[model samples]
Target: MAFIGASRGAAQGRSASALAARLGFRIGLVGLFSGTLLLAALLLFSLQPMFTKRVLPILGGTPAVWSVAMVVFQALLLAGYAYAHALTRWLQPRAALATHVLVLLAGVVFLPVGMAKGFGAPPAEGEALWLIGLFLASIGLPFFALSASAPLLQAWFARSGDARSADPYFLYRASNIGSFAALLAYPLLIEPLLGLDAQARLWSLGYAAMTCAVVACGLRLRNAAPVAAPVEAELTVEASPRRRLAWIGLSAVPSALLVAATAHISTDVAAIPLIWVVPLALYLVSFILAFRPAQPGPDRTGRLLSGLQIAGTGCAFAVVVFKQTPFLLDLGLTLGLLFVNALMAHRAVYALRPPAARLTEFYLCTSFGGMCGGIFAALVAPHLFSGVYEYPLLLAAALLCRPGVTAGGLPAVLREARRSAVPLIGAFLAALLALVARGPQLGIEVLMVCLVLTLAADWRSPARASLVGIAIGVACLALQAAVMAEGGNHRSFFGVHRVYTSPDGQFRLLVHGTTIHGAMRLRDDEGRASTGRPVPATYFAPGGPLSDVFEISRRVNGAIPAVSVVGLGAGSLACHARVGEAWTFYEIDPVVIRLAQDANTFHFLSECAPDARVVQGDARLTLSGRTEQARVLVVDAFSSDAIPIHLLTREALAIDFAHLDAQGLLAFHISNRDFSLSHVLARLAAERDLTLLQRLDPPRQPSVGFAHSPSEVVLMSRDPAVVREAKAMGWRAVTPDLSRRPWSDDYANALEAMRDRWRELLTSAR
Candidate 1:
């Protein structure tokens, strides 16, 4: 009966619709993986960002915090993979399952997700390691257990001997699908529906559900009768080292391509900063295409994919040469290239996959390489190369990649180059483009010369082609960025910030990462400043939440309230000081302070308040250490694309409550294109015992509102009267009660809250 059943299953797979059914199931199963992976990713992705934000106000808004968080995540993933490998090897399946469940239960005990208060403060130079170690102890175990699901499940599927016709790797397609959804859902659904508190609960609930499912899966498999392989499983010992290395290369090539795609897209137009997701999204899609148990045969697709990769590389180089963003074009071409390269790489992996007995080892290499790639791009590259030139050079290298099978006995590059010389020269001739921002004539002339020489050499030899491509990258970097580093530009680990003094000379502007945090007008800073008036700019616009707080402070007597700002971007808020107003800034990045102050762009100290105190470290960390009573406190940390969910929790808000005077107003910038932060604030307001009023007035102009990352702003206060006062001072209440639960230190999952509404949000008004 079992042999007949197996034959039926195998026959079903070979039928026309069998592949479709398998592919469909694989794509949809991704949703489940999305749910499973959420907890770990939340710890790695959300918590790190959250902790960094909580501490950013103190660290001076330095990019280093983000960098450090990445290091932690990569290390933890590596550790998790190692643990999964060990568990599958040593423990019997049931024992492994029991251990995972118990570990997960233990992780929940660390609950109410948050770093210890004041952990954000800059540690003594010698204490950084200890600091990180403590943080890992606090959040690491739960994350580690959760991160192991994919590998653990694969190992189980391998051992169970079920779905003999189905590829264990098809499950990975679903896993990545889950990963992409989490990445997308956090910004779109999770943040807006549930405040950090409720979000945490929802995430915790999902974790519970996943745990149950895992337990159920384990229970079902334990009692199932075992089936024999068709005598094939026993023969599949580990392949030779050469073959293993080939698999690693297959995985690594796509990873390298992903990093290159990230760099290419960034270089084309680093302004709005199209992040790494598009490349990664396509990379995930390749699994969907490549991993079916019985995929349609490779038809002409392999050659097509190879052609597109070469073309994509050439086009990417062209954009760099021409100096045009061609935003949509770049996105389309890069995505196309990513898809093709990923498909080819995945197919190669598919062909190379060992039998079910060795499935775990196969995926171990893949995930390890993924973790390695992330470290390379996020950790190593920043330290290794000062610029993104490695991106294009890598793209050039990707074009040369042929399958290992094709690598042997290919037409000699020398012969091919000699035959194709004319076309190569012509193609190079067209690629020499220079921007009008710099003198177009001299730039174009210089590029034309380089292009001709490059084509000539590329047509003759592959090595020469690679060398010429590197030269072009070097030249492009020099022209686009290298020549003008000291003036107007601030290059830091976070991203580039450009300082341009307004043409009128009335307003000095300060830009950081990608947004303008502060601005100062000459009228406010120069002659009028001595007259004892506070200047308003950026967040302090009359209709903005921060400005509403300042307006409420007008009635309070005595030395104008000492205002503490967490994020100091060009010290634009310094211009808002009143006659005796003492403003202390908690800026995270030293580069930000230097650029804002030394550049003389927005003279917060020199022009507005020279004696203002500037404290450095995470704001909450700094605030947690102090007992100052400010009438108004402003938290505007979500200006970057990176949102730290931990900062918006009920617990953290309660800490804010402690530092505020009875009438103190806390202006939270809830404006975000992706998240409904006002809702998060509302949830926190209720949970932390605070009265909250929210304003949804987006600046008429795109650039006028709160820090740029968030699209809207809200002000929360412990006192309802304080909120009411801010309302009278121009604060608009968009949501009296947004009806979403708050995200807490314990659990949060934005994907569940607003997942349904995201598609519309993407298509709707700004």
Candidate 2:
């Protein structure tokens, strides 16, 4: 009896030991899969800004570059998700794991990623395609492999035989958390701490680590039964065509809005990746909130938030249209609208999510929608519309996706209330017409207020409320278009340009964003439209620093001077060219070139220097290849208030020097409302042992023949006579701040360089 009892105890102990071992293995598997996914997401997101920064100099520092890069990423994401979906559906667990691991291993060959060599000098035309090809050749393989990670790993986790594996969608939230963390780390921590080379090496090490984790995950899954195998009970549902389309529609709105918001804000501000990441990071946050497990809340809470979203978006549109707020406030409102709208759209998608068996399919559809939205916003809109019509159109689409709006809600409402609602509708239309007559300010205000009241009164009826909201919003947009319509308004890859005549019709201004690029006098002092020689206006007005540079150049050269102007802003500086002088213009945007050369539009180039040569390409690339020597080289290329940092770097200065004669002066138009570049140019001049002269021209009273705008020009030369002549004309010798490092091609901190000016701007705004 005693021997039998002892044997029984030993067998029971052995059974307990086996159970513990299995639990440990399950925990290990979860860690391996989750860790791998987190790392993969981190690398994937961080690589975007890193590689784009690497190639920004090759392209001009246009915000369109980032937009195109997003389109590429979205397309690759769809391909990766589609690939994962195919692999899992066709093959067993072991086969899928093996194939994915092999692909990852193969992708390692593209490690330590940077821009590819031999793609020198972006072509003047087809730049978008060239940029896309450059990205594909450089980091395509690794990025594609990494893009497969979120959906692929979540699918693998579902098949891992753990109880929690039944719903793998939670893993998606974790993935976005990783992505959000990475984007935040980039500009805040990584970029500030490490150089690009170090960043590349570190990313390579992380990639290797992720590969090993992936292998470990694969090995764990190798012996387990596939989730879709006959023995395992898996929940599967048929994804109907309508359901797939719904998924695509819901996902596309936020993606397009993301690009639109980025473009809008970046055009007004700077075009750096740091600014680009803010909207994207918020976009990821919305995904996190939408996809996470439902929290305890009242049923009406979501409806209330939805109503608020619509009202808030309408108000934001009004504020933007009327220019009633500061830039920062406008930016905040735009981002807020994006966040709330995205949350609503993404939540709708989460509500319709299929079971784990259809996980890959759901993600694939989502990626496809993202790709479509990106293509529309980044590719199609630039070709289709002369303004940012995509922004307003997507906002309307988002209103349609709001909850409580049934498919036939508006039609049903109209049919049910034909008798009672007809007068109401007619009254609303009359009010809209009255507001339109009053002008854009009153129109937007009345429309926004009407939308808020309409939404508030019928919050429960989503369809009725959404219809009213969308109509009001669209009407407001139409009114805004009319109000903001200045003749010759055009949009390009760079930014939007508008030509506006001043109130007295004496000045015709070339405007980009809020900055006036050039102003030409339409009528003379005698109030006649004098067709004499075109006078230099705005920053190039007579007695401005730019004019001083020309005077000094001609005097020092003792002959006809060869002048090269980097930016062609209505060709205002062309009037500064003398009869015996040679002038060439290097302009990046073809639209600007066309507008400047048009005889009817300002005609400075045509009237003053009709035979001048205009080169169309990035100045950094085009100027470097020029063999002709310039007695004066003017760097005046600025898109709105955004100064391309690449054009101001030490290497760019070196190129400028190489293209200048022995006594040539390099003048930089550093006039900016948001940043101070005096210190930057001073540092560069000191490093190269060149004399630097800076002048801040005071604002002059407006005259009928010319408008005098504030201007700041910095001149650098190896000759002392150039500095002396500049000082005689109110230009001061600026000393370099030794504490601040000179900006170089390999390193530049635009925010740091502009820190002081930013503080002043904010303080004044308040």
Candidate 3:
């Protein structure tokens, strides 16, 4: 009996050992797949900001650069998804693994990513296409490999015979979490801590590690069992065309909104990674939440969707109508609207997601949708609309994605509408008030009422919801028309440029976004439009620092024979030219050049310096190769309130100094509402041991005629005579802070500049 008991115990011990080994192997497989996906996603997202920053200086640092970059990213993502789907569907498991591993090995050759060497400078026209080509040549293969990993690995995991392999869709949540972390880390840690070269090398190391993980996953797949018969049967049930179309629609709206939101905030504020990342980070977060297994129930989902839609509509109305809003509030409202809409749309997509058997095909369709949306926003919209009308138009379209929009069809919509008559009547009354009031504040109030009525009318009826969307769209269109009617709106690859006369009739302004680029004096003391000689008003007004800088140059070096101006804003500074002085203007935007040179618009360029030379393309590229020297080089370029960061770097200063004579002066117009750049210049000057002269010139007088803006000008020169003369004329010698690092082509911190500006403002207020 004792011998029999020992035999039973040994059998039990063998059974337990087998069970423990199986559990350990399963855990190891899960970790391999999950870790591979996480690392690939991290590399994919971090590459965007790093590469875009490298290309930023080639073009001027316009917000459109980031927009175009997003299109390229989406297009490649679609291609990668298609590759994964085709490989999995047509090839056997071993063949597919071999193909992918080969692709990964090829991608390694393009490591330590940067732009291709042969593309010297972006063309003046078709810059979007040029940028796409640049990206394709530089990081195309590596990015393609990274983008494929999420979908391909999930498919592999499904065939691994693990308990969870039947539902590999959960892996998507892991992918997006990595994406979210990457975007957050870029602006907060990577950008602040490392230069572009260092970032590229580190990313390459991570890529190598991810490649090893992928190989391990393939080895595991070799020994795993085939997909279960039930799963294969599920795969044979193909997704219908209508269902695929639904997936496309659900994916496109949020993708388009992501780019639009990025442009909206970055255009007026600053075109830096910090601002660009916010919308993208929120986009990933939406995906994470949408794909989670624990979702709100039917009733709770309805309430959440309704509340977010209402709030988003109101915020959109306020932002589209009103041009000037407080910075923080404007940014907050835009980002909030983005998150609300994206989450709603993504939830709808998640609801319609297919089983894991069709995972790669589902991802392919969604990626195609994303690419289409990006194309519309980045390539089509710039030429299609005079303003950013796509923004409001997309907002209206997103209402179509709301739950139950097609539930009852037209008849049910009619019934719901009849039931909602009271709210509809109230909304109509509010609309009439908005039309009559024509005030921005009252218009927003009316918008909120209409949106509430629209949402509450029939949450499930497309017809009813669309009616409300159209009404709000028309109202927004009319408001935009009113604003544009006052100006000549010109759309360009750079941004929207508006030329108009001020309401006070004292100035003809050149505006971009919300900031006035240049203002030309329209009226003289006698209240008549000044016609004979163009007057340089605004930042370049008489007795201003710009004028003083020119005057001091003349006093020290006698006749100033040649000058070069980097930014051609209405060419107002051309009036500062004396007879026989050769002036050359470098302007990146053709629209601005056309307006400035049109004698009918402003006579500054046409009348003042008709013979001045005009060069097209980015100043960094166009200005760097010049061999001629100038007596004064005025770096006064700006896009709205934000200056191109490339123009403020140490390398840019070297380019400026190279083009200046030994006794010449370097003058920078550093007047900005969002950044404090004088300290940057001071640091650069100290680095080169050059004398720095800075002046904060307030308006000389407030009057009905031409008035000057408070200009902050910084001048750097090695000549003692120029320095002495500048000081005598109210320019102070600024002491540089050695602790603050100066900006360079490889590294810059726009976020720090913003912080310093706000700190200065708060201190002054105190």
Q: Of models 1 and 3, which has the larger lDDT?
A: 3
By summed lDDT, the worst window of 10 consecutive residues in model 3 runs over 404-413
Q: Write the per-residue lDDT of candidate 2 for residues 321-414, one digit (tens) a residue.
A: 5665778777888888898888888888898898888899999999999999999999899888776767777877787677555244346656
Candidate 1 off by > 4 Å: 1-245, 253-282, 293-300, 303-341, 354-360, 385-478, 483-495, 499-509, 518-552, 555-559, 599-602, 641-654, 662-735, 738-766
Question: Of models 1 and 3, which has the larger TM-score?
Answer: 3
- lDDT by residue (1-766, candidate 3, tens digit) is 8898999999999999999988888998888898889989999999998999898888899999999999999999999999999988899888998999899999998988988879988887899999889999999999999899999999989888899998898888889989989999999999999999999999999999988998889998898877888888887787888779878887888899899889978888778888888899999998988886655556686567656676667566656776656877877877887787788778777777788889999999999989888889988999998888888888877776665653343466566566556665677677668867785446555755666566655544555665566556666776676667767788898898888887677788888887777887778656986778867877888889999988999999999989999999889899999999999999999889988888878788888899999999888788787989999999988888767899988999888888998878899998888898888888999989998899998655544244677889999988888888988999999888899878898889888888889999999899
Global lDDT of model 2: 0.81
Predicted candidate 1: what Cα RMSD to the true structure? 8.9
C-alpha lDDT of all candidate models, in order: 0.58, 0.81, 0.84
Model 3: which residue pairs collide?
404-460
Q: Tell me the TM-score of each prediction against the true structure.
A: 0.66, 0.92, 0.94
lDDT of 1 by residue, 102-160 (tens): 97787787666655554444553423354456568666775676777777776665555
RMSD of each: 8.9, 3.2, 2.8
